[model samples]
Target chain A: MKNLNRRDFLKTAALGAAAATLGTKSAKASEKLLSEDRLGVLVDTSVCVGCRHCEWACRLAHNMPSPALDYYSNPTVLKEFRRPDKTALTVVNEFENDKNPNLPIHVKIQCMHCDHPACVSACIVGALTKNEDGSVVWDDGKCIGCRYCMVACQFQIPTYDYDVSIDPHIRKCDFCTERRKEGQLPACVNICPNEALVFGKRSEILRIAKNRTKRKPDIYINHIYGESEIGGTSWVYIAGKDFNELKMPPLGKNPAPGISEAIQHGIFAYFVPPVTLYALLGTIMWVTKRRNESADKDKHDHHSDSHDHHSDSGRDPYRTSGHNTYRDSGHNTYRDSGLSTDKDTKGDNL
Target chain B: MKPAPVKHRFFTPGVIILAVLALNGLIFLAVRFISGLGAVTNLDNNTPWGLWIGVDVAAGVALAAGGFTSAALGHVIHREHYHAIVRPALLTALLGYTFVAFAVCVDIGRFYYIWHPLIMWNGNSALFEVGICVMIYMTVLYIEFLPIVTEKFMGKVNLPGFLETFNEPADKLLRMLNSGLSKTMFIFIIAGVVLSTLHQSSLGTLMVIAGQKMHPLWQTPVLPLLFLLSAIAVGFPMIIFESLIASRSFKMKPEMKILSRLGSMVAPILGVYLAVKIGDMFISDDFKYILKFDVPAWMFMAETGLIIIAFVLFLSKETTRSPGRLFLASSLVIAGVLLNRINNFIVAYKPLYDPVAYFPSFGEISVTVGCIALLVLIYRAVVIYFPVISHK
Candidate 1:
């Protein structure tokens, strides 16, 4: 008995340790794929001319519908702030520069591709995944077009092909994944006339962003927009105007999925909670069934001794006996059923 | 002592209306599959989920929680008096889950890929947890309902004409299944309750990922707990309401004794839900949103107000004992839960670039109404043919 008791304690201790590990697994596993030398883009709104050349180049590269490159130069369209939609994978929006009224800040809007991407966490079918290269990519074959990614995105970058009935696609910026395979920069970076968009290793470009901000503190805001928002993003921004005024959503340092995943893991750690609940319910059912059975026996035998003799029997007899009581109680519980007509008629009047 | 099939005419003026409503829904449902969700639903890139998800799927799941709650009370607690409500509750859950699955299929862009979630699992996703648990629970519900089928046909497997030769064999199979299930049903019963707790809470976790998009009034870390508690609280009222309506429809005596007892237990559950909901609001300092009294605030008020009113009603002996008062109280809770789900999924979801506030399109409303009408029709049909409701 002592040996068995020791073994049981050891087993429970191991299980408890495993459950503790499981509780923290989600946060750790999600971070394991993040690489130090991951590619990223630095967007300097101070340098961007709002020429919209990157917009034309992005469309041409993506093989999506676009007019001539000259059509993008038409500044009239930039009058109204445009978001990156199904048609445009990236767009440059002009913001009012309060410091220098003549020179407006043209902030490019696209997928920030967070280090801890919420879309990847929220995707029901693992359709979206964050790559080691710092690009959050979507698989065509995997997407069910639920558009939960739209709801989860802090930037609201993903757009659905809603009008298309058959094989509707979830459209979003893929950070020029195809072009990068051929050792080329993103189309936006390639077409930037003023070097407003810088593409390089995330850590390296972050250093450059900090240097530029320190060198020209009067010109650029001290804070780098995406350095730590939602646990950092691939696209870092150095802008002259306030980021909040630029319509960049203010987010905390914690990842979008942090609190939610913590709760999820807590509830489902090694499935212990569920199994324990099941066993607890089973025990309650067993004990209560026996008590009810003994009560019923007491009623029938009209003797306390026989009721006590009914003992905690095996599963087979107890289950069958429980059903027998259920069958009998159908009448006793519904005793008012036979007399409910007049009362029900009155009840119906309400 | 045994439950027998209710003997009554199937159709009436109210039923005709329901049939027409269902027909209207089917037409719209067909339009959706053919023309795409954009053609029928008010959903766009900004607002992805609307009436179909909020009312049809979320509210449907919440309202159908009677199955596990009753099972817990009747079988697990061994309250033999409540066993009469179990079969009906099981049937309701089975049908409700079926409706939820169908709504999901319709809501998703690629309906054929619906089975992908079963194979392709994402542990990080709250939705994935909800999807998996709901799938397994549906299967468990079916296994639990098999006893009713075997009981109805075990000794009476009489086939007609050419099939008559196989009647004895069929009877034997039924008997075998009956014996096997009688021994094994307890496993499925406990499993159903466990799964219900898992997915019901995970359903709340679904909107937690929405973050800033969700109004602060409803958005909190404790949403899952609130959702689970609300689901349990609403469970008994749903059973009470269904029992009263079923009896009235069949022109039979309602099981007032059991229903009244069920009613007495409701106030405490609702109280727990209220305490948690209000407590979370105060602790999180989200009570400030409630003071705003804007549309979202009013919607929140309406949601909690219904539950608060129902809770007060349930606390009184006058309400629990009187069938009319109990019915009214139960309806309030059901409506409150329905509104709460809609508020959580639709009204509270304020996305960036929302040009206009989303309202359900006419097609969307028709489809939602049609599904409920169909569910009720099916419930009526099943109880008339099967021994679900107990009576003398």
Candidate 2:
């Protein structure tokens, strides 16, 4: 017993060392893959006027259908606050303060384009893709239209056209990928007359956001929204009020996608579970087969014992006399019916 | 009478209702394509996703987890005690995923581009894995049900001359096929188990991106654990309920002896889930929210209450043994999972500076209902045609 215990302990120790070594190697590889040069956007809420140019530009740029409600006709629309839909990629909403009685603040709502996007992580079909250039995009061809991305997104930026006859796709802001490729700004950024939105590299935007805070400490909130929220977003904001006051959700510094992925990847990192499960199943089937064999043997032994008893009665159990044959035929009838397990037993022969 | 082996096939009540729903659903889908998502859905810029997503697809996948969990514990673990309950669990999971696929078809804006993910490889996105897994998993589920098809159609049947050529000594052929299929069953089962685990947990991770928008009661690093555990907790109970209904309806022997045993095993997992949930809240100081009587706080209480009720119902051997009680308990467990998902994704989630709220349009609700109705129709068809029940 002692020897067996020592051998098992040594075996476990060796396996542990191997597992640790493999784990470190994978971690090192992952570290190398993590991108450092993240891109982002800067929004200064202090200098903003409520103009719906972003909405118009977004629709036109994407070739999406025009909205039924005229942008100019609905002056209070901003006051009502709008959300980005399948058609409308971005919207500007007004927030008024009853106490201060200042001009209502305008906040633009669009896809935040997170540094590590949850939609990207939630997409199983690779429909939602994150580009190396820091823009999170979508590919409809691969999408089975399971809107998991919409459910998983913290910003809830992606919208689906549920009314489409056959194949509806997820619609949202894509950081104006085409325009960015042509060295142009996103439609929203290009159309913003007040310069409320600033488009640049994430590092540059972070610098600009910080400089604004340093220049006028009292005018803007110190923190930048999306800087570290959900592991950061391309669209960062400096708001007039606390983030929660704006109804901004509280998020952790780490990517929400990462937390869930860690557990998912950990348990099923490779084929550990599948292999283990098979080995266990095979063992059970093997055991059940053995039990069946033993049950068969027990029945065979009982039949032989019963045959000895019939022969000892001197009844000529194996004879072919007419009376004997008649009884033999009767006994064989029951045996042929699959109702008798004991092939050699006779109740009256003894 | 053997019920003519097949039921009357032309325009059955179930089929008629599905046909009507399909017509309406197709029309709504048309409007969505022509006018874009804004035309039909109650979704907005602030609330980007709606019921088409949170309820139909994401929650649907979570519910379908019954198949993998039951298969793992029953077959892989060599628990003959659980064998009686496995088939029904797989059936529920199979139907759930079929519904998910239907929901997905109705949920996206540009439906034509749905195949892009399979053609492309975007490993970075969690959505990528979710989509691929769901697609592959659905196919796997259908394959898993093939034996039922074989047992019903091929077993104890006379083949025509042409057909008989393929199945000389058909019994031997079937036995061979069964054995061959069994030998490699582990591969499919393993893939199914792994994929289910990935996507169910990914469902929780999907919400982590929302950050501050989500209520504190739900937001945590332990979301994956919570989702997977909840899925497993609901799995056995789902199987039990299905078995009870099928047996009672079909006038067959109730597999209560085995089902109750499985329920006993599942009860502790529920207890562990609740403990971990509370423990996380306490450790993170997020438990403070539970003290408040606000919507978020009340929702948390209600969610936990339902789960605890399910746990209590299952824990007692007497209640677990009773079919009615077992069914009710499992239903509650499933309800608890749905409510938790809705709370995390919709009810408790609030976007910044967006006063606009969402309520699905009549058309949106209709489409979702249609998808669910289709699942029922398919389930009915499969059950009637396949020998899902054991032949004693």
Candidate 3:
């Protein structure tokens, strides 16, 4: 018995240790703050010429399906709104310029790569991670394809390879993580004809974006779309019209996961709430058990007092009546079926 | 007293239909596994969860609340009168969770990596909490059902062929297991209840991170509490619903006195649930959204309206006294919770960018229907073979 108990203790200890390590690993991902030198892109939508060269360049860089570079140059494709999907990692949609209706403003839509990404916080398996380079990348090897990330992403940027039967991966812009490794600019930035997309350190780009907005207040909107929106995104946009007019969702300055994590962690902090709940339930059970025992004792005394009368009745009236009708049916078929009306009155009396 | 098998013929038209549905579901499942979720489901990136998660997982988990509630009533609370229903409720829960896990397997794109959550713990993730809890609770449920299995096979382990040689040893093992389980059963029962409470609420927490995606009508900080309360409210009703249906099907007398007492309990629980739900909406100042006449608004109205009706009916003496009325009231509660879960997880969730609507494909619906049919078939089989349903 001692040996068995010791073995059980050892096994439990090992399991607890492993669980603690894994818990710390998950917590670390959330605790890591945005890096100071993280890269970002400042998109001056006012200067974008609606060329859609970035779309062609992004498809080529991601090695996704694409028409020839010339096919993307067709301005007619901008008639309808478009979103980045599994086939396309990035897309450019043209919005009718409210300030200057003659020239349409084109906004490139891709992963915003928020400082505190909802997708990373939502992933149960820690498959999506926020890297130091301001890139929110997904590890296909770690993904369980739960798609909670897709549901949690505020921008709805992550797309799934739902068509693939085997080893399908979530598709999204990685901010050209591989290209950055070679010290090369993002495909869309490199391919922009008018230098509309300015890539630099996040702080440096934010300074430039603020300066541009201040210098050209008449030509630009008084806001940076991604700055402090859901805790600030790596991709900032400066448009000539209201950001809402460009189909950008109006979000609060607070991080997306703030309220959610606070509520979840508040209730489950150190598992205190669950433990308290169990204790409360246990107390209820104990009280009920004691009350029931006393009630059973009272019934026992009452039964003993009428023992002779019950014996004369040839059955314990309390036990063999009312709700116990089905129990009695197995033995006394005549009483159950033939004397049904008599039994009903007797059951009611009991 | 030990439960005994009900003597019912196996080949009813209802059973045949259920079998057909189960078989049809199996065919779709094969397609889903081989051709991926896209072939069998209309689920895309915007709508990752469809009928499978909403109906099969969420509703199924809520419906299975009868297990913990019954166990708490019978063993922990020492309400021996409820003992008659505990076994059946436990069986239902065991089967319910089993199918829930199976549905999850089919729903996830990488089905083979389902075990990853166990070792790859993300304590901060509500889904991680839900997954771990459900997995542990399922095991606890099965453990709680072990004594019944032992009771059924205790002295009847006589085998007819080469296996006959091990019959005596099996009987010994069975007796040992039965005795050992009885000693430690309360631990598992308590664990089951704790785990159930954690996961039931965590299911609501799973959607909290969706934040702005979920409609304000269903999304609130108090959502987890509401989910847990609703689950608790529906627990006794689920058991009552199952018991009344089982009695009618098996040609047994409905335990009216006991069932009416159970029915009476529902009103207070439903009262608490309704109060919390309405209060949460009012406090959160989301009641204005109810006037929008949108799909989510209508769904919220219907969901709350059903529960209110059920609560009113349960409070009435006539409804509690009549078995049919009681069954109807219980079914309403069940339907209300089911609608609440589906509405929160699917109907009320709208992606920010995607204007495209999502409706489960025929194959997805079939798979969900088949899962329910299979559950019923298994329940019937268990009651017929094992000592699940009460004979006396």
Give the TM-scores of the predictions, in the order they appear.
Answer: 0.91, 0.74, 0.88
Candidate 3 lDDT over residue span B1-392, tens digit each = 34788889877998999999999999999998899999999998778889999999999999999998888877777666566778888988999999999988888888888999988876567888888899999999888888888988999999999999999999999999988987777678777888898889888878877878889888775677788999998998998999998998889988787789888899999999998788666556787898898888899999999999999999999999999899999999999999999999999889776677998999999999998999999899889988776655
- RMSD (Cα, Å) of candidate 1? 7.5
Higher-ranked by DockQ: 1 or 3: 1
Candidate 3 Cα deviation (angstroms), residue A155:
0.8
What is the iRMS for every candidate structure? 9.1, 11.9, 10.2
Over 4 Å off, model 2: A1-80, A85-113, A127-134, A137-147, A156-205, A224-252, A270-350, B1-66, B81-84, B110-115, B155-176, B189-195, B294-299, B337-348, B351-381
Most TM-score-accurate candidate: 1
**Model 1 Cα lDDT, one tens digit per residue, B57-110:** 888889889999998987777665566788888889999999999999989998
* DockQ for the candidates, in order: 0.32, 0.21, 0.28
Off by over 4 Å in 1: A1-25, A303-350
**lDDT accuracy of residue B44 in candidate 3:** 85
Locate the minimum summed-lDDT window of 10 residues in model 2 chain A.
A341-350
- State the fnat of model 3: 0.53
